[model samples]
Target: MEAVILAGIARRVLDELLRNPYRTIELRSARNVMAVEAALREAMRLFLTYDPFEDVSTGTEGLLAELMEAKYLETRIPWEESDEREVTICRAKVKLVGLGRVVEVERRKGVMLARVRELFPHEMDIG
Candidate 1:
């Protein structure tokens, strides 16, 4: 039996093209090759349900690998010891994890850049 699927239908049609003389064939038949056209309609219904973009809206192939593993270099403060505020610098690039997307939030002081996700390896040099 050969099953050929037609257009716009999820079901298939079976046809017996060959006849056997020495063997008795009732419900059991053999098919060489069959084409599935209507099966696409049903398969598409399942694919569209769960897509890769459910979490991430966009994903670019290459983005310079901006974030990397690094260590906090130092903290720079402008005020005096009594009421001093500190700034932070990392040794190398920082690692970004669990971030669906990467986008530059803002830049400060021309040299200071902040990212959307928090820096990993939590314990970093702080002043």
Candidate 2:
């Protein structure tokens, strides 16, 4: 479930990164895992605006599955940042499935959201 929650957080930042194209370096600012989790929770609550208590698939991974199937996310990576230097990124890229096309996120949010667009382009919109 952590995946779902993380995905949501990454998505939120992705939206922002895509909007300006200059925020690509913001992903390196995540200080810890807890911060990532918090960002994910915020994304789920604010953007999704769904109650976890009411939904059975409220787990982090569960949420990610829904978003992927719905064509929301394109890629995700599990990494840790401590030096504030953009040279330590080493997480593998995970593809987030859309409704019709397959989009791979080259760099995920918080730690790598600035490159989401270069990583994934809008090829198909199933919804």
Between which residue pairs do clashes occur in model 1? Answer: 1-29, 1-30, 68-94, 68-95
Tens digits of per-residue lDDT for model 2, 46-90: 112122222223121111212211111223343664433233221
* lDDT value for model 1: 0.20
Best by TM-score: 2
Clashes of each: 4, 11
Model 1 lDDT per residue over 48-107, tens place: 001112221222111111222234334557667736465444232212121112223222
- Worst 10-residue lDDT window for candidate 1 reads 27-36
Task: Show the lowest summed lDDT stretch of 10 residues, model 2.
Answer: 62-71
